[model samples]
Target: MNTIEIKKISKVFGSKTALNNINMSIKQGELFGLIGADGAGKSTLFDILVTLSAATSGSASVHGFDVEKDAKNIRRIVGYMPGRFSLYQDLTVYENLNFFASIFGGTIEDNYHLIKDIYEHIAPFKERPAGKLSGGMKQKLALCCALVHQPKVLFLDEPTTGVDPVSRKEFWGMLKRLQEKGITILVSTPYMDEAVLCERIALIQEGEIMAIDTPVAIIKSFTHPLYSVKSKKLYQLLKDLRNFKETYSCYAFGQTVHLALKNQDTTAIIIQDYLHGLGHENIEIKSIDAGIEDCFMELMKKTAE
Candidate 1:
């Protein structure tokens, strides 16, 4: 069964469209992701789905409950952790947990089993003010609070945005554990690497969904022959590659710039020779596998055209 359904949903604020006729159906127990950078309407879409804000047009439902008329029922069945830390900063860790639990008429003990693994890490600092905890600890506490009610659907909006890498990894681990226990998660993240952790992801750009599929499938759909190219003059190499007549796409990828030739007609050595001719020394160009970011870039280019 699909846990959430959205149809031609759009949200406009005064002069700008935050969401543009978005459509998606998320399956039960699925770890689905809305992958995009900030201002891509991820938060707006989440607000609409969680019934915190109404859509300007079209419809959305969570667990068969309409986001408009049946909002109260939707709220009861969904656990939402917004991108920001909205918990009371002045309250102690334990107080925040207790407060959220009490709001849903649940005691921490009532849902202790659901969040035991996460809560235990923060329990040692239960007496500390929430504001005093590190980024990772704050994340764990927020998650524990969100799960205390044991909601069937979990909505996390960029949960790991500013957290440390280690905490981000550990948080994904916790998500996997939650999925194992049958909770449907709809998470959004600006991190391309994080998108691969989801069972399926929808790549959103400028309030529109560029593509929706499993991570592997999306990467496999990349049709261009891609190459990782590097040179001593990294910045100049990027400009030169963009100006290359045969260059289809060229973008920096960490230490190397990914180059997609207009045609597979030129070999890596030929491209390297070409760069060498242009005064670029110590140049390296090699074929490489495409990842989620590559696919997203391709999709965005396609959509822009």
Candidate 2:
């Protein structure tokens, strides 16, 4: 079953759109990801789905319940963990968990089976006030509280942002565990690497959806061929490559500039002799396997045009 369905959803805050003409469907038990940098409208879309705000147009449903007409029913079956930690700062870990449980008309003991797996890791810190806990610790507590009600649809908006690298890995491991329990998860993150962890992802930019597919499929769809170009004079090389007639697109990606070729005729032999003539020797330019980020940037450029 489709746990979440959105059709042509658009949200405008007066003159600007926070979410524009978005459409996506997430099936039950699927780990769906909404990936983009901040201000990409991920949070706005999440807020609308969770009933924290209303869409200016279009429609959405969660677990077959319409977000507009049956929002109350949807709330009962959806768990939301916003981008920021929303737990009471003064509340101890245990108290915060218990408080959420009460709000759902249940007790920690009643939901122990649902959260014990994750909660146990922080059980020793149960008495620590949430405000005093480290960022990673706070993440775990927020997740535990969100799961206290055992909702079927889970929403996480950049849950790993601002956390340590080790903690980020551990948190994803926890998410995998939750997936085993058969909950449909919708997580949003700007981290391109994390796109591989989801069953499918929708890349967004400027409040618009760019591409939606499995990470592998998205990476595979990158056409026109790509090459990593680098040299001692990186800055000059970047400028020259952009002006190269054969270069379709060029952007600095880490240690190299990713080049999208304008045509297949521009061979490495041609590029090499051209750069060599420009006083740039020992240049590194070779075909490189494209990744999710590469595909996303390319798609964003296409969308803008």
Query: Each prediction's Cα lDDT score?
Result: 0.93, 0.90
Off by over 4 Å in 2: none
**TM-scores of the candidates in the order shown:** 0.97, 0.95
Best-matching candidate per TM-score: 1
What's the TM for model 1?
0.97
Query: Tens digits of per-residue lDDT for model 1 on 255-278?
Result: 799998778787887888779889
Give the per-residue lDDT digits (tens) of candidate 2, residues 159-236.
999987898988898899899999899999999988999999999999998889999999999987888988888888
**Candidate 1 residue spans exceeding 4 A from truth:** none
Candidate 2, TM-score vs. the true structure? 0.95
At residue 292, give the lDDT of candidate 2.
Answer: 89
